[model samples]
Target: MHTSTEFLLALWTLAVVEGLRVTEVVVPPFLVIGQRARLRCHFALEGEVLYSLKWWKDGSQFYQFIPRNDPKMVVFSVAGVTVNVENSNLHEVELVDVQTSSSGQYRCEVVAEAPTFNTHVLSANMTIIGKGRGALSTSAQFYLLETVNFGTQHHPYRAPWHALP
Candidate 1:
């Protein structure tokens, strides 16, 4: 008993709901044992409100962000995963002293609030290598060399040339 105009309006409403989408999930592909790893999850809500943001490792939920909750943030204990709550939020999670066991698939889940309640998930793999095996690639080495600041502007320090004489 619905008119064509009413059906078209309903379709238009759904089309413009502005559902949730995960823009990017950044999980470092490689990390040296004992190093801190920062994982970031970027999301776009369009016109929707965020209901919750969660992080999972190997299918285990480790961190959550609920905007309406009193505490707003919660951390769960998972083997090989240590959450640095101090530096973690809806957009990023920091893991301190990552170990070899930390290697796993990291996933970010975002859910929108209210009538839409749309959800999006994205994941990336991370690996932890022993210190000896974590040598930087040639390109990475060159990047470090090019961007490293040896000293303050008042005391500029060059490389081998500075120590030559």
Candidate 2:
């Protein structure tokens, strides 16, 4: 009977080990390829110091911001991925020059300093909407610019032009 009570107590203790509460997660569903993007993760800790905050894209580590790191490590970023952390205020980050490859599920993982040593993770998805597809479609529209000083007159609006496949 006493052993059963001890087991239950241990289980409860382990459940409370995760001391961080993620309040909100913000991500845009559609973004232009050339425009900038922003991702925010809001969290509240239970009397614990922040150890590290990291961002992952499609299960791969992309960006990391460590607060309590000694020597104050610079912003961690992956190759080919441009994450602007200069304007980041502890819980948010901006992405510049977004690309079609930037479309993916992004996860924010926050870790608390020792004693509790808790960790929490939240994720959201984003999509990049480009002007055109990888391959041009037969029905795609093509705009013709006005002819300067041409003998014939030009239409003010562009007409729908389809190319042969």
Candidate 3:
């Protein structure tokens, strides 16, 4: 037994609470091994407070940036990879000295502040390209390059065994 006005109000409420949505995720199609690249994320909510932003590589949570946290940003180590959380800009993160292992789907998860706690996730794949096959081969190439050049010329794109240090 609901009045017409009450039912209309209920419909309006339903239309407004449209959870969370990730607008876009921007990542370079390919990254040069041993070079740095930034992955950008954009999100929006109907009308909710932003709780935090979290980044994941290959479905594993590696970094989280919470505005309310003491440190504001926290990171976890991944094999053959380095993660630097950019606090000033909440849109992107700098992955320094990338490696082959860095090739994977990067996800940006947006969580709403409390109450509803709705979450929206968006992901994009990143590819790492290098002349050498693997880390070992890349290291060998570097050693030879150093010996041949006598430490004269430096290649910025060339990565060592542990490229993502």
Candidate 4:
């Protein structure tokens, strides 16, 4: 019951309705342990109040940042996942101290109270590598260099526990 013209019109309508594309967030591919990494959110729409921001995964809410409710920033984790909220910028959030538990597809929800704009959902892909290693043991040779004035230093003193004999 549809003509060629109708089909063309329908296609254009579909494109316009879904045209407001979501923003893309870029983050580092890898982060060192105890170092901080930030995921930046940018949207086509600007000047939004950004009333509240939330991060979620697997249909479960992880963390939230709201200016009115929270006095200081908060980072919370449950079920082996973590979330961090930073509202330093205008309409973006920053997560610091990237950990292995922070690797996943995190969905960011931003809301604007006035003007009633569409809710924006941005996803960030996070990955963590190079962690969980024991500290290196102290070497006797390293200590010998520092104690050059001790007992002529002709022969280095080796700890009995670490000596071959």
Best by lDDT: 1
Please report, as a residue range, the 10-residue window in candidate 4 with the lowest summed lDDT.
139-148
Candidate 4: regions farther than 4 A off: 1-21, 46-51, 57-59, 63-90, 112-117, 132-165
Query: What would the per-residue lDDT of candidate 3 be over residues 108-158, giving only the tens digit for each residue?
Result: 999989888888898998878665444454333321122234477745443
- lDDT agreement of model 1 with the native: 0.83
TM-score per model over all chains: 0.70, 0.66, 0.67, 0.51
- Tell me the tens digit of each residue's lDDT in model 2 across 30-114: 6756778788998888677888788788887876777765543345566435777576656777888888788888888888888
lDDT of each: 0.83, 0.72, 0.76, 0.54
Top-down TM-score ranking: 1, 3, 2, 4
lDDT of 4 by residue, 1-165 (tens): 999999999998885444223477666655544456665656554545556666665456766666666453445555535334434443445555666676667676666656564477867565555432343544211111112246665544532222112
lDDT (Cα) of model 3 = 0.76
Q: Which model scores highest in TM-score?
A: 1
Stretches of candidate 3 off by over 4 Å are 1-17, 86-89, 132-165
Q: Which stretches of candidate 2 lie over 4 Å from their true place?
A: 1-18, 70-73, 77-80, 133-165
